[model samples]
Target chain A: MFKRKLFHNAYGKTLPYLLLIPTFAVIILFIYWPAVSSFRMSLYKVSPFGNKTIYTGLSNFENLFKNPDYEKSAWFTLFYVSFTVIATIFLSFILALLLNQKVPGSRFYRTLIFSPYAVSPAISGTLWSFLLNPVVGHVNYFFMKAFNVQVLWLTTKPYALYALLFSSIWKALPFSIIFYIAALQNVSDELLESATIEGAGTLRKIWKIQFPLVSPITFYLVIMNIISSMFQSFAIIDVMTKGGPGGYTTTMMYRLFLDAFAYQKTGPASAQSVVMFLLMAGVTIVYFLFGERKVHYA
Target chain B: MMRRYKKPLVLAAEFVLLTAISLFFILPILWIVASALRPSGPLYTYANPLTLQTFFPTTVTFDNFVHIFKNLHFGRALLNSLLVAVATIAISVLICSMAGFGLAKFAFRGKNLFFFIVLITFMVPFESIVIPLFVLVKRLNIDNTYFALILPAAGNGLAIFLFRQFFSEVPTEILEAARIDGASWIRIFRKIILPLSIPAIVTVIVMVFMFQWNSLFWPLIATHSSRFEVVQVAITAHRSTEDTSWANLFSSAIAGSLPPVILFFFLQKYFVRGISGTGLKG
Candidate 1:
């Protein structure tokens, strides 16, 4: 094997290691070290500034479990992650199926729909907040013109979470659409044609052929949306709702952010991150075991 | 193309569905651009009535854009973000591609172990680790510096994966021939490998640039000074204050988002390929 490596006899004994050092150094310092530190810090009540610490053991976790806010955050995070995963997969699959129809102007539609993936969350939040503003906003303006009533999208309780849901789904649709479109395109023309020859209707063909072929991507997207909702929702919550009316939209990650950064409660924050890291790992493991088995090469 | 004969009505319905979905994606972007272009005023003036002018400024002005770059130091923020992204790309591309080449070509000690590390890191969401990373960054006394902002994200495991996949396909014959001709491995890499790896390099560049440009959380914690404020953080500033500056907010968000959008338009193919390449096989 060494003889058949890039150089005969594998002459460059140290070159590969040298090439790998920078990459390994970075992950060790930034990823692995921090991960281990997060596990460590959860056991100690570190001061906000990191200038003080006490060995508090599992008390921080006990406090986290006891905190009403943490409970609320966990509930919302569950709701948010579930809704986002299901909705994005369903909606973007529709968009992708439509785009895959070879519709006239499909290219134009594809370009516009997939453009949002390029948008930053900060900008997305700003635009959504502006559009969903209770007064003098287009959404309300149209609602008022059509229905004669105004809804407080940002300032109200249930509406704020729903508003976030809308914006986040809007932001996420393009990404999933891109993936689904790719997956749909990968489904073979021969199988589709055979289905057509067998008198299968579009819906029948989609349900039978397209759906199974794209299941892997759907599963992949489910994992992605969950990870995104769990950890990457800071800007959206920050700009649009500020986790607000009360803490209605605060996911556990946002709760952790607030505790660690805003409130200086480092121990509970570390515990929250530990939970997040495990949740993400668990989801990815499920994807590997289940979703990987569902892959259809054709 | 799998073009099947369908009723024109069905075709029309598909067209309508496609167009409606496209509008949902386009209108918000148009709203931001239009509202930013409108002459500075209270947002209600332009937004209240659903007229044609709601999405198209009656009097187009660059003043909002100018005002941000001039007064708000958005130019500096743009520079900072660009610097950080470029610095990251520069460092990331070299290291990841090197690791990619190394792993692709070498049957070395701990190869599988290193590959496992890369896979694990790639599988882990970077955002989930930010708090811990912040702790590490603070501990190292690099908090609130460029080092903190750029260092953590500089070595991307996915980019290495992409490069490894790409490099594996490259034939070993050329390198062996070059070695026989007295070419140093580094020289062979520069001459043979780098030139042949443009597509992989482009993919990594796009990947790194997008991540760096769009990141808000790490940058939020890693740096605090106004001087180090990135475009996303600067955009957040537009809304954080009690008196949210809608004009500046709209303007800076538009300006800040342009770089990645432009990259998407120009390198559309790579962007799509990068998406498809992420873990799941498309």
Candidate 2:
């Protein structure tokens, strides 16, 4: 009995580690090893074939800062992230509040809005590209018919970025809307009823009570929107304009792709990757530092 | 009397606002379907582009889809996409759920540390690591292979975390009872835990499948030839080619989106439950 019990205990003790081996192996191989390799690769000047390498130290990083295109890409990324994050969150918040108001056909409307969540960013960009086509786009048609202004939506400076921004905000809405709707529904009715009894106006009641109640979700969405706009918006930018109109809409991530694939500047590309990773790390640190404490647990 | 009148007015205003927003979301989707059906020509010479005619095709046809399948080779790309997504789902689900089960049911040193590492991995985005990942795949000579697409995406941290959360909620007493009955851990997991956790498994499957299906950047780097182009990458390649038919591009775009959209419609509940369960908000 003693031997059997010992054997059982031994199996139990080893089983978790055995199960964990595959996950750790993949993580190490794909994530951590790549991370280390990227850092190392950034310090070298890689050949055209990525086989021959020469040590370059921080010169690759220095050259990136010296390059005007990289600076422009960074600025564009900042602008895109801020615009998309704020616009998406604000629009979704308003939509969520209105959706929660017991409107007629709310269920149908909810499905309509959330359906876009299923569409990939690439497809969303295509759909938007059709809608904003310079020659035959409906929006431009409306512009011409109503305002007599012929606007270039996809191939113009500033306007191309706006087109990209529009699609980004459009696709980003469903996630925020879903969360906001859930948060709004979870807000206790008794609290709202008491506020109503106190003769609080509808907007006032929402701002003072419901808004604070859902602030945790709002905070969380803000961080996610920032990260998404920073990183995942690459698909939209790629599909919409390919960071075009003289690189007006080329965010850093897209620039990284252009450098590596288009120009074959692997060392600079890896350095740009390290820069993006640091930027992401900084955002995460800020979120934990400032955003987490503001999150109210229900 | 004032209250009765005011409520209806508010409802009417809300209705107008909602209709406008819903149109904003739905109109573009309608436009894609409309564009796919409408006969192609130069600009508005084909049809009135902005009117109800273009928004809803007067004469609908599947010519563009036929073109995509026959000429653009999107049919093969769609098959490749299916194979990649299925392989990713099969491998990721097995590994993640097994890890989840072990984390949930077992006790050992470094368990919390292992989970923390998973959490940290989740926080790292693929974009930041793509270069090195590409190099690694090339070094292994798996680039452009099915394993290239499948392996990188297989060990999903969020899925593991999700599975852990679900499995942890399974009562420990049941597993203890099984152990007392002399059932081995693997048998108990297969017989008791997995069957009971079907909902969670379904949720993970749908989530992983959607992710793999919709993936663009990695697949773009991983494969170079027409033999390995997934649907999303194929769409981009199609778009970039000069003289590619706009109608066919529109049709292919819609075709590519259909799988996930259809899946979402069928599995809407699981998507919602998965999002909320994974703590997307908090």
Candidate 3:
């Protein structure tokens, strides 16, 4: 702390603290306070009219558990998070591997591939919904021509969930690809040349050299993708499915949205938020605890 | 040896693989752009038959774009999004960089605790607490204003982390020399440090701008009126379950996505930097 005195004669002791004030003010007011209050808010009974509150501890959690729809939402969230995160990361890893091939026009290919990074999930839903429209969808048209079967995409159950999964993975793919490409670029040519000299083949090199070299980023993407899938699905579900075909696509985040915004179940929604916070924050915490230690690379 | 080992057939196969993957990513965007440029029609007219028309409109027109701006008030939505983004970037860069500067240049009591809080805020995704943040913002009577949309995001932990990481690398000798030259703290920061922080500033701007531009959920909840509607909200507005307006939707979606796409293209390297700047670099 003796280094603090180097510039202190001019900076004044309070300057740093003064500079930090706005950041703290915003973080406290917007993030931490709200997070802390959500736990407290989950416990109480809150009226929809914003006029009443009762300290009914744990009832909101009880009600959420009792609701079968909540159970389905939880199940869907599990699948959605797992599928979207894994598929996006895995597929993007392969795509990055392709781009890292230094193929002709790699720069153009990289730019085109990551363009969807700029598209909002809401807009992605619009684009995907248009692409997957039941009667006119090119995907369905191709299927029909190949197999002679009409497949309903957005209007059907399980298919709607599939739509959510597909678009979400597509929307989320570019982020992982960009990160993975960056990661892959860090794999040294010397290492790869040595591996090639040792008789390692293409797939083997990717699986062994490049993959392990990028595991830290893969882990980062895992945590980030898990967090994003929870929220980003909200927009897609809102636009493409609207949690439709008997709410098949409604994950916990979307369910929480509906309960809070549409149905005005503030208490239960708060409980759901608290539950999701614990689950997701638990992922982050575990990442810090173990994933960081295990995955740190040269 | 790595590039030489590939046979002509394998190289051709990799080339084909790259082409197919590129098409997979580009088709949806191309479809939207194609549809957006079309004159109004039955929503599915060119989408089927797997024809060339599916990829290109017969009569290319600016009518859909004109229609949304002329009738649907999409221009207002664009303005709203632009305003929010600018405000967010302005406030975010200032406060986040200031916090970053504080942490980087100073060693103070409670520094570890403060840094830990900043870390925790980012580690927790902002979307998780929307329900309660709504409550807090409502109580503060700012829920329906731009403040609600911009303020919460302005306190971005990632941006602050990025700036702190960057600022730590700046030589202390310059700061100390500037102080010795009788430059006050504010002058030192503005004259000496801010110019040196152009890269960090641009990265933060790009990060904040993209986050604000592409945001839907927070704006959807935090603000309620058409007066406060953002680009994402306006685009989604066309997708109502009842008779959906596909022309307006396509037009608005394309228009809304342009800013970030253009920004990414121009600042592609910084875009990569921002991604890596999120506390992970490979």
Candidate 4:
């Protein structure tokens, strides 16, 4: 009887494992297997027929680092990620705080603020490209009429990055605002009231009490912004500029696209991808190491 | 006495600032709509100013919409996107929810290892895996099929994680009672767990639907023919070729973006809850 009970108990405990098999199969087949293959491919050399898999012995990595285009792509990616994250966070924090107030039409305001989040990056990037068209764009038309300035928004060197940044921040701000609003709502009302009772001004209460409470959200937003800026902004660049005006906006992922698909340098592309993965993983690890301790849950 | 006025003044300032910001966000969308309707001369002419005339074309018609469908094969692409998205949502939700249920409610050895594996996959960006995935897809001879787009995206980490987090919140006693009453595991899932988890299931469906609908890169690489092209790829093709009509291009873009926006607006409460609830945990 004891042995029978033991067998039944073991079967009961193992049932969940049976249920998880499909998910594990998917991960192994799609994610883990691909990741492992990519890593292995990075170690070899691939050719056009795709038949020649010569062992490169770290030559791909050496080639990747040696190429000046890689440096340019890296710099552009850094600039894009940092600018978008900072601007999106700053603007969304202010918007979240403002919308959190008991103002009339607040619901409408919240919806309007979040409206952009629903639009896909591809569509939004196309729309913004049209809007920022140097010759026919409404933005330039208005500026030319008002200030008599026809700035080449997508062509000029430094301004090109700014245009991309503007488009990215516009797309990302609604998401950040939504997150911040949620985080702000979770802050204790008593904390804010006590700050007020201590003779604190609005700015003081926000700085001393509210900002600290929302730091975790801010950190998460930063990480998301970085990831999105790295991987997803390729669409924006593809649509808006095609990494154009002499490759001024050729981000790392875009360059990876060029190398693998356009240039047919599959081996180097795989190598670059591994490097990009390590960079992103390193950043995320650092973020978690420092930020995890500071995240306070109520 | 002065403090009362200060409050109203601050509120007025906030109102003004917020309205201006909202206008900034809304103007581009409004311009897209306006440009789509504007007449021939103003549509292509740089010098022509945006005016009340621009807002309403002199000959107001559905020329843009009709032209996109008639000229650009956008109808086919839209249909393809709808098929892929719906299939993705159905398959993903079912598979992920089952996995999530297992992870959340069941006590099994190696559970933490499996959960960590899911998390690692979640963190690894698709860009890292796209090449190998392409090679795999090619080897399997599934390239250019709808399966190329749907299958890889169906078992994503985000949906699994979202469902698991939600399933964990469900009470265990209910499942226990169902089991005691001689209900099978699959039966408990269907009758007890699923019925109680409709909110989360809807949330996963919407979220996964959005992701699949907007997906571009994988489809761009995987699919070879225009017939197999999703809406996003169609848009990119329209932009790249330049021979395609601008009115048609803009109209297709507008149409492609409308479904999600409308769905989100109608089901915004659930959408917002899903985002906030999932985002906080992440």
RMSD values, in order shown: 3.7, 4.9, 3.5, 4.6
The structural similarity of chain B in model 3 to the true chain B, as TM-score, is 0.88
Docking class of 2: acceptable
- Tens digits of per-residue lDDT, candidate 3, A1-298, equal 1232323335567888998999999999889888888778788897767669999989899988999999998998898899888898889999888898866788888888887888887788777776787678888888889999877788787788788888888888988898888778877899989988899998899888888878878887887788788766777888788888888888888888788778877788788878887786677777777776657552
Pairs of colliding residues, candidate 4: none
Model 2 RMSD, rounded to 1 decimal: 4.9
lDDT of 2 by residue, B139-160 (tens): 9999989899989888988788
Interface RMSD of 1: 3.7
Tens-digit lDDT track for model 1 on B14-60?
Answer: 88877788888998898888989988888877877788888888899
**What TM-score would candidate 2 get against the native?**
0.87
Per-prediction DockQ: 0.52, 0.43, 0.52, 0.43
**CAPRI quality level assigned to candidate 4 from its DockQ score:** acceptable
lDDT of 2 at A113: 87
Positional deviation of residue A152's Cα in model 3 after best superposition, in angstroms: 2.6
What tens digits encode model 2's per-residue C-alpha lDDT throughout A116-170?
Answer: 7777788787778867876777788888888999889999977998888888998
Error of 3 at A16 (Å): 4.2
Quote the positional error of residue A30 for candidate 4 in Å: 2.3
Task: Sort all candidates by DockQ, best to worst.
Answer: 3, 1, 4, 2
Residue clash pairs of candidate 2:
none
Compute each candidate's TM-score over C-alphas: 0.88, 0.87, 0.89, 0.89
Task: Quote the positional error of residue A290 for candidate 3 in Å.
Answer: 2.0
The all-Cα superposition gives candidate 4 an RMSD in Å to the true structure of 4.6
Reference-based lDDT, residue B185, model 2: 78
